[model samples]
Target chain A: MKWALSLCLLLSVGLIFTPNTLHALPEESGKAELWLTKMSTAFSELNFRGLVVYGDGDHWESLEYRQTQHKGTHLSRTQYLSGIPRTQVRSGNELFCIHSGDHIAGLTPDVFKPLNRDLASKLTTILASYEVGVFSNIERIAANDAVFITLTPKSDDRYAYQLWLERTTGLPLKADLLDIKGDVLQRFQFAELELNVTTPISMFSSSESGHALRLKPTPDRVSSSEASWWPAWLPSGFALQGYNKVSGSEGRQGERLTFSDGLSSFTVFVDHVENDLGPDLTRRWHATSATVRHTRSNTGDFRISVVGELPSVTVSKIAESVTLVDQLASR
Target chain B: MTDRKNESLSALCDGECDELEVRRVLNQFSSDPDLREQWRRYHLLGSIMREEPVSSIDLSEGIMQALDGEPMDEVPARSQTPVETSVAHTAADNKRSRSQWLMSGAVAASVTLAVLVGARFAYDPSALDGSMSGAALVMNDSQSAMESEAISAITVAANEPVVEPLTVANADISAEELRKAQEVLSQYVLEHENEAINANEQGLPTFVRVANFGADNKTAVRKD
Candidate 1:
């Protein structure tokens, strides 16, 4: 009894100094959420110059950029670092894409269509899909200090990401997209960065502003009266965003359809004639990911191709539904 | 008997004991409560190094020396400091190796795909054949029979019955032939665009023209 009592006393004394596991601490998660919120806000409010290296598959290219925020307006200029003598300067809704080699002026109604609020929402959703975590210490980036955070995706559909954001401004210093095996599929890093610089208004003006603004011919936006005869088995989360009807030689006719998942978009083209001849085009192009599938409708023989980043099943379902409706018909 | 029970309790805390022994200790601890407190104390001793500063021995200098391989004999207080060290040091090597393993796996997959494609086309004889005409397919050039004839000759020389390589090889065809192919592709794209617009005017979707753009940003040019 005496030894038992002594053991109990010693154990109770030791219990007073025991430390808990890191998994039990709430502070690390707090740090992750705080860092991401600051990053999102800073991207919209801060003016920072940094190199953006965009890559897909084996191709890689770098762009030099300058951005300035004044009052409520943001202006940006970008020049390709590679072979092309091209420069893009944007001010609000206007974008001037200049090709120095051809002396051609490329004009667009809205240069930075990606700066919309919907894009922000999409990015928020994308980030939330990952396990948010931080590294142990900060690292220097382009002469400025930055903090690194690792985000591991919970699903296979998306890739993991490691981002280094500026410690002071929350601007992204570098980003790497890693596959399931943790190999980097793509990387975007800043070669140089200038934070909070005073940019002149003239910097936003394109050198080709005096030249003619050549507008690419807008596509005809007309839907076929035959859309009513189509079926309705589109994939979940896919919404019809656009459609048009076209008439070609020998009365070769088709209707094109567009779909969007609120972020990534795709298109489907359904060509038909009042004959038994099946679709002549049944192939796919890597440049567009357009998969052609042919089917027969009571009114005509149709050739359909689904084009987008989505799975082939989604495209197939949408392609199966090309109906024909009279102009004045009601349900 | 009491010492043996405490030893078992410690083993349970370390996750070395069987479930039956764990249950027995848990039951006894639940009734007495003090044994449970003792088990936690032993684990804490091993974990506390993660959080607190050491006081009695020069364990920190020992750790620093172990990490950086510098002798800390110059420190005068080595004898007085108590060591408060963490077991996490032992696990660092395991974590680093696991991350490296994952990185290598991903690289292997991508690299294998690249190598296979490269090797398959490395000795493409079509590009070297003189009769094989090359065209910059994106330019609006006319596709004459000579370009077709050149493609056939090259295909025959390569002895590959597949026509897929022919299409790919034609991408580098002469500027004029490339112009014609670009016109064909552009016409196809415009046809689809026209269809989308017509559908939209009738209250349908209008977002089809630029929907599926791959990394290839090449556009078909029609020169007058």
Candidate 2:
């Protein structure tokens, strides 16, 4: 009887802990960090070609995407498929836009900015505000089986996320942005993907008609910190990533402050305009929305716009909180 | 059933009908059970007569079933570029296959047939005209649908596409607002898109590729 009771106790103990172990989050294994790190590195490391499809409300679009790193220069091309021909090719820090017969190259210094440390540091910002867990769910994308990682935010400042990482390559083949209600706000996924495909030199060549337009020089960029302004309040988990002051021709000046919670980010642009062209126009692209609000500050008429994947109302609140502190006062 | 209705079904089976009759028959497909039954029977009879082994080739029901059972979160599309340049894909495909086998005979002949038809379409310059706008396929919530859909399968190999015109999902905006929005939006979008896309962050890069200046729309897949 004593031996039998001991055996029963062991069986009960095994049953008691088995479910908990099976259902355990990846916190212990650190697989969440591993998966996220893989996702961040996959794009730069892998040379691939694929089509990405996304749609919202009415307009849905697909694009042919090609990414390659030649001589340490990353040449990624995004070609729009459904409409008139407009293409953007990002080679290192320059974004070359070819439309119709016009070739406009806008230099982006931001891309070359040393990744705010490694991708891990950037992820740490997100991990600070979000809880990472593996759903133990797998789905097929681009004919590859992808495992799902659910990012539940530690705070409600941002939306929840579910990233589908291809197991073999650890690349993110698909991602969905969900609302507080857990409804999907946007989805960006690769419908057809072939990795390690040899990209032709001409594929990265300029427009179909190589007749060239002048490469547009970047408007002057100053620091956003010099703008002598800061938001008195911001959503939880959001921090000032960076800001730049922009000066275009004819002396039009604007300062932009960027904030990020790792997963979601928004830019506040205080552009000085000649006229009152401020309409709160909101555009949703995939999961991100750009809401532009025109307002007037003490200096003159300014258009304060917030562009992000976050809710318009939430961003609007951030926009309303922009206060111009004298650059001198902060010191 | 009236003989006239039966005749209409026969014509529809034969792939002959004006817009009016096509609409009428299409309407009948949903409302009239007798019409549907007759339609099925007519196709069945024709298949038997033709001596072509009959098959349940319909996939709409399967597609609907798949859609119904599917969980909403995961779906993907083609590259950031997509256009109806199925013609381009077809052309590149020919070059691709021929170059693959210029010196070797190991490649299958079926690939040759597909290339030939694709080449024919590619050679027609008018098909390449900017004016020829077929309804670009909208892919939502089903990357798997690409495997089942022949057109998308063909498009996967298409190449050298034009940039897409600025179009938004929100269609309620007037053309003026859209134009203005595009002007204001594009100016900001370039800077913001650059900021959002670059510097090795996966989240922003993914969002920017799928949003802002979006991917080509034609070769994309949809997920709900």
Candidate 3:
């Protein structure tokens, strides 16, 4: 009888204290912070497989890609669903753009200024820059319960974010890429995700799987003492990352210049105009994120194309302000 | 007794009283200072409840000092029992799990919509070229299509000088070979342009051109 009375007393005490303990707001805040930290950590460290949709302008395409980061090496395989089926295999900085009629070998610079580290560290910036607090209760994501963390953009330069990360693995199950107007510009979601699965080496194909034209060793591949000849009035935070001089089919030389603004990059091309006249007068769309600008000088007509996830104004500005320094004088 | 009425008056501060009760309370407070004191007491209790942190609120030093004066220190100290906390947590966890299930379904539906729409607009380059002007170069009467083709092909390969009318080779090569050679050179130029764009480097190097083949000498100028 004495033990039963004591147990009853303990149960009442527990019931009374439970509400008081649950009412503490700091504990809830701590839980949210932990969830965000875990989500960021997995993005960089984990190997992920999923289908992604990429779009620019009106051109949108769905693709299946797998990204693996192991032993400090990053590899990806991209398969396109368009005509003359193509597959792009990338390991580290190298990519093979494979196709039936043609295959092109490509290289992107190291220290890809955009998304500097992995996706994980980028999320930390999201938490820091925004007043990150749960706007409501837990939300559903990709058939799993996820905390819907909506980050309102404080500035007009960038977009807002609505991230849905998994409750278990803390991986981003789905993400909505938004524009300034809060409209969904693009969407990258995991239709299916497997974490830490045994991946086959054969899953990665050599870029040479398609018919390859015997590529001549391009003149741009040949090193020259003539890099400093051309310079640009690059925007603040932009850096010259690479230089390649390709000879045109007519055996004329063309210059490819790469610049990056810590996160995003733009490519600028300077070629001797093969046509007798200048480039087209009107602006037109090539792809979603690509804009081409043409200018003429006494030397030759120049074609400047700026491509990236940037405002078109930014690209056009970069293209127009470019000035070529005389190689002989610079040397 | 006046304080009891003032306690009711305190409830009146929250605009909780209905219209009839509000009139009654207003009439009663006007005549009683003792009722006013009760009203003050009621206001004080109401403020304290509002001040209780619901979510991560920082307690001011004064508030902490007031809390220090309370006799509930022993109760808060005992509040952190792991087993008891976990019991409340299980219920909350169940709620969260349901929410996750709902969110996942929404995400799957949204992703399917995005993918199906995205697949419709694959890049088609030929379809994109809407502006075709009269840009093709016109050939002179002295230049036959075969000779012109051969000259363009040579120019495409090594930026070599265009073949002059006077320097036409008597060597027999099929017209089909000449056309094939021209196509190969055109493709090379396009590929080279793509490479330069991707590399984002220097300008295209100078190619050799014949310039003006003099009517008398027909000399080729090897310009850099």
Candidate 4:
């Protein structure tokens, strides 16, 4: 009886010192959040060049990537390995996406960036929706001691993510998107990465063989605003990032709205559904998903498409909540 | 619109009619043309529900009726879409490698019938093909599931002749209007993805994806 009592006392003492699995102690949670903020900054502040293997579903690509900060401006570039020549180079706000020696359809880099100047605060705001914690055991990545940090989604509206950060520099060494079953749906890991090395600024310039495409029809200019409809309900932490209007063939109107929660984002598209037929066009891409919904009203029938790195149900809820902004105000 | 005797005839088809109503329906079946037409339709529908082939020698009439009931032109023409093009390219490795689709000659005939329906009208031609019997059985409840599966098979094997039931939906929506809509939406696709890429410190992740996308989508356009 004395031995059993001592064992029970020892086990209880261990439990009291150890943080709970789902809910970390306040000090532990704050430290984890601080690490996440550092991870975000380390990626930008530290100059690194390495080969990264990115994956989504069954698709895989090997990319030679580099990021350099010179004179307070960020410069980044990515080149494909052993395939048709495709590259994207960004220097601060100037963006160039070259495909087969031509600038294909794409928006400016700033369009996708969060509206806030401070990325850390945006991440902090999103912490409400996630249960952030650090693993007790340290992991190794690319020859570096790393801490495993997990952002387990508090709700099903988002996916859980595990990121391994270099212990010394706090740079993200590996990232994985996990499904409810803890299965990795997407992964980006540096097979070989160099840390805190000075990079040549000219490395950010596009050096592809083909001439860049003329801006005759520059895609997604966000030049006009014919977006009469807006979603009444948005998920917690999501905010209206941007909106644009493009004139369609023969004077038709189309609207695009973007929303983001720092780490993830989605876009809603509204247009007239002229003779809309057949099944909803649902497709999943590397870390992205697209779903199209057809909505009908007395005034007209509309085709609503939601695209993002978000859960399908969340996107669907956002899409279903869309209503004509002017129409709602008047009513 | 509910004709009194036709309603009685419908009731008799459900096996719920009293003896007197059955006798009345039987007595009128010989003289009332509309009642006879309803009886024939109910029987045809019942066999379709049972997943049994309709013995209609003139399939053209059935095709025409199916087209009339479900407008073929009203489908959202979503083929040749950038998203699908990407899908086709990524799945190219797993796409059917064999040039010949392995199925009975009758199934091939069914595929030809689907093409004929698309060429003549906008409705799912494969549904009119002999496989329509199976499609009709599950279509009412799980309509969208069956339709998308049918559409994917049809779009993938568009150049090949291999048709089956539930693989006959025609999404040959009007091209120009569809291109306009897709063009508008593709912008959002890029914008949304671009934003995600922009958030990346190095743009290593999303930037390469765009390139792979370019390569994959190019294959889609070329194949299409």
Candidate 5:
């Protein structure tokens, strides 16, 4: 009787502690999420410089990338090595670009914040749209051991992403953008990387002869509700990020609405047209698609365009769904 | 799987495998479970290398089973009708000619505004010198003098009416119309990228995109 009881106890303990059961748990995904979190933190916390090759199937460019954090401020510089001479410097939220003696300055989001906070807060939102996975195989990238991570789209509306992160530092060494068919549409990979190197702050400055052009962020006051026209349908998970009304010569005006789904984004532009009523046009540049549609409304002849790094079909659908607020009300 | 076979599979994933190699891979793929598993891993690895979502499930077994149930016969090749071939050639020719026209026309039209603006800045580089402080001041007031000047330049170019009549018969678009469309599209794309740089948590991809697209900060300065 005692032997039977002990056997029952042993069976129960074995079921609880089985290796397969432990392996089948969320440990793998949890480790992936943890690695992703580390990568996010590494971007702001680590100092690195490398030669990177970026391509969009149609075109490719080589660039020198350098990043460092100094006195609580994150700074990075990207200098094109293969193409037309251009340099972009980012100091905290301010971005300065120097090209052909022209200096362009603009503000970006607060990128200095350790990105892990944002990732942790929005993991649920992101997981809703993408399935995260970690590959068991260890790959060598940028001459360093790396682990592969993937964010697969739950739907066909968005593209998938694969990243190879350095195993030790968690810094991303390579990334690929995949279309729905699993073909690589774009790729950014590091050929050589040196971490923990000193990057001088002077590298982020523009020459005195460079012309300074400042670009302001979109005004926060112009909400989608106040827009004269808006997209009737957006792919799931997309939300309006900003809106702006632009005035051209001859009293002509246009509106721009931007939307993002955390990882992907697209913009809608509506402008008044006067002449040359051409048929609809679709243009592809790299992975980005630009679709233009001409629509005549009671107000005037308008040109609507949807542009983004999305599939051509998605942009066309978005372009077709734009409607004037008044037209919506009348309908 | 042999290393040679693995290389063939990788080439197939990249769409580089020739027909003979494709046939060989497909043959081995159907009969060997290990090869099938390797195929799945190769796809998953390919997805990861491409920075896309990975799918681990292998659906080829069911597909091959279904294919096995179908009757196999030597299918006759169907040649395109002469009329169909002529239509295809005509369409291709039209596309080639229209693109050729656009190449030169767009250059001339786009350069006009660029030269005008370039000359203005070239004549007085100092006008843009104090733009840093000017931008700081403009932050408080959205309608700044600098912004108006930039906006006026763009508006002047944008308001220029299309001179050529619409070629409705041939469906050929006018250069002015195409130029305007390009300008509008480029502006929105730039703005979208700017916002993306702000919104995206991933740091390097945005920089890669900006570099890939050639940071044309000249037009980025005009928006209010």
Candidate 6:
């Protein structure tokens, strides 16, 4: 009778503790998701300016980053302070590169836009591939108390990310992109920041030298039905985000397909080549990898290149997996 | 599947098959659903054994269906006769086979290299930050030399142009060819960065990349 009573008491403790332990994980992850949502909101709604230091491997540079929310329009200007003289101003979906006092305008849709209004829904999809976590300890960044968060990839196809977001404003004060090996591939940290700073309207205006070149907006989505070439395989979570046909000099025609898994992305370019380009070559620029392969189809020789901030092996696999539509039709 | 076919599949999974065996397995894989399932299972099992993350979702069925919907031309049968072929045809065949061999070798080498690099990084104390630190931090001093050696090995294996900043691959190409490739890659990188600016709410980080690239390009030009 005494042993039975002790067993019952033990069972009660296990039942009570098990529920709390299970609930703890979800609660922590929920808090991380909420912080991400708030960070996304603050990006567009909040106005701030600061000096940022960006580095990758041995390369490092300082830049002045300014953004303002003016009349529901997001305007941002970035100027390099430590390196070559260059300035860029972004207004809505348009980006102007000011070099030598001339503005080269290009339509970069959603360049500085807020995360999709349906971010709550999209976060579910992101969480499927990444394990989002909020560190319990607080950290100081740019003189502000910050909440550290990590978005680690579930697979080796993508790199990992760490962010230190300001506690009060939820603004990311420091960000780091870590490789699969956990090395810091790239980092962006604010050195000094000021919130709610008013900027002159002229700062966002185009240079007095006027626009030297204006580029047309890329066609948003060239449907799969219209695509002549497509990748036979992609990293699990990646989805086709954009597709467009491009014409290069000498009448070379090419198609560009962009794939993204919410946080990471890669682009495959298939171009008609006049001659064979020998063996496949792989290149790495900091975190980005570019792999090129030459393939022959019934129609002609084609050059396929996969470029992205991914591992070289992943990029090479993507390049090799590109299949010609006509070739597939005839297989 | 026959016992012989099963043996071939296993050999292929181990990457020990010759060209003819690979071709045979691939042909069978296209037609036999059972073989496809077995292949998937073998891969899943291998991944599990290697301690790699494996996703339960399989999209191969949908991919196969999509391919089946396409209008396929009947494959021509191999002729027994030693018929004369055009020089171009023979050269193309040789090139295709060589390319396939190179690709296969590269994939194998890269997979092994990735495992080595990953293992090294996994145990390196410096890889983890203060928040991630625990028992790993205790071994930092002892492992510093190993970490440096591993990093150098990775750099060499990746063929990173540590000497020439902002240059593309250090292949045996003319300076002009290298320049052209660099310009094209830069443009692609910039375009990709623009598209992914807001990906995962990473607008500022992506912008920083653009700015960095711009500065590097200018510096490269100045040096040249």
TM-score of B-chain for each predicted structure, in order: 0.22, 0.26, 0.19, 0.25, 0.25, 0.27
Query: Mind giving the per-residue lDDT tens digits that candidate 2 earns over B1-224?
Result: 67688667544433233334545665676677788655543332222222133332322222222224443233232233321110001111233333422212211222222222222323334544443221111112232132223222222222221122232445575676665655555445445544633322332211121111111212111111
User: Candidates' lDDT values, in order?
Assistant: 0.44, 0.51, 0.40, 0.51, 0.55, 0.56
Candidate 1: what lDDT?
A: 0.44
TM-score, each model? 0.45, 0.53, 0.42, 0.54, 0.56, 0.56
Give lDDT tens digits, candidate 5, residues A167-263.
Answer: 8888877776667765555666665678999987888776653323332444544467779887888888877867766654356777778886656
Which whole-number lDDT from 0 to 100 does residue B102 have in model 1? 36
**Position A193, candidate 5: lDDT:** 74
Point out where model 2 deviates above 4 Å: A1-29, A101-121, A207-224, A248-252, A273-286, A289-298, A327-331, B1-191, B194-224
**lDDT per residue, candidate 3, A216-281, as tens digits?**
222323343455234455555455555666655456676666654433445565656445322221
Which ranges in model 6 have alpha carbons more than 4 Å from their true place? Answer: A1-27, A101-122, A210-222, A276-278, A329-331, B1-187, B194-224
lDDT of 6 by residue, A13-126 (tens): 988755221322323787888888888777767788876655453433456778898887888887654333567777876556665522111222222222333344457667
Positional deviation of residue B212's Cα in model 5 after best superposition, in angstroms: 25
Candidate 6 chain B, poorest ten consecutive residues by summed lDDT: B83-92
Complex DockQ per candidate: 0.02, 0.04, 0.01, 0.03, 0.04, 0.03
lDDT of 4 by residue, B1-224 (tens): 14587557544433334334445556675577666655544433222222233332323234334435644343332233211000001111222311222121122233324432432333435434444222223233443333333323221212111111111113664555444444433444654554433322332222312111111222111000
In candidate 1 the C-alpha lDDT for residue A255 amounts to 62
Poorly placed runs, candidate 4 (over 4 Å): A1-27, A99-101, A104-118, A208-226, A297-299, A326-331, B1-191, B195-224
Clashes of 5: 9
Worst 10 residues of 4 chain B by lDDT: B82-91
- Please provide, for model 1 over A1-331, each residue's C-alpha lDDT reduced to its tens digit, 9 standing for 90 to 100: 9999999999998776443222232237667766766666666666767554443223334566777776677677776643344567756544456663332111111212212223444455444455677765556655557777766655443345566777987676666555455544444555456788777878778784322222122333434344644435554444555665655335555565666443335666665534332222222221223344445655656555565533334444555554444422443
Clashes of each: 51, 54, 33, 5, 9, 0
lDDT accuracy of residue A18 in candidate 6: 56
> Candidate 4 lDDT, tens digit per residue, A1-331?
9999999999999878653433322238878878877876875777887655444323334456778888998877776531344566767766566665323233222211332124576676668777887765465555567777777777777777777777877776667676565555565555456777677777777765522221112233443245678887787877666665644434566677877666677888776645543234544443456666677767677777788877656776777778877766777
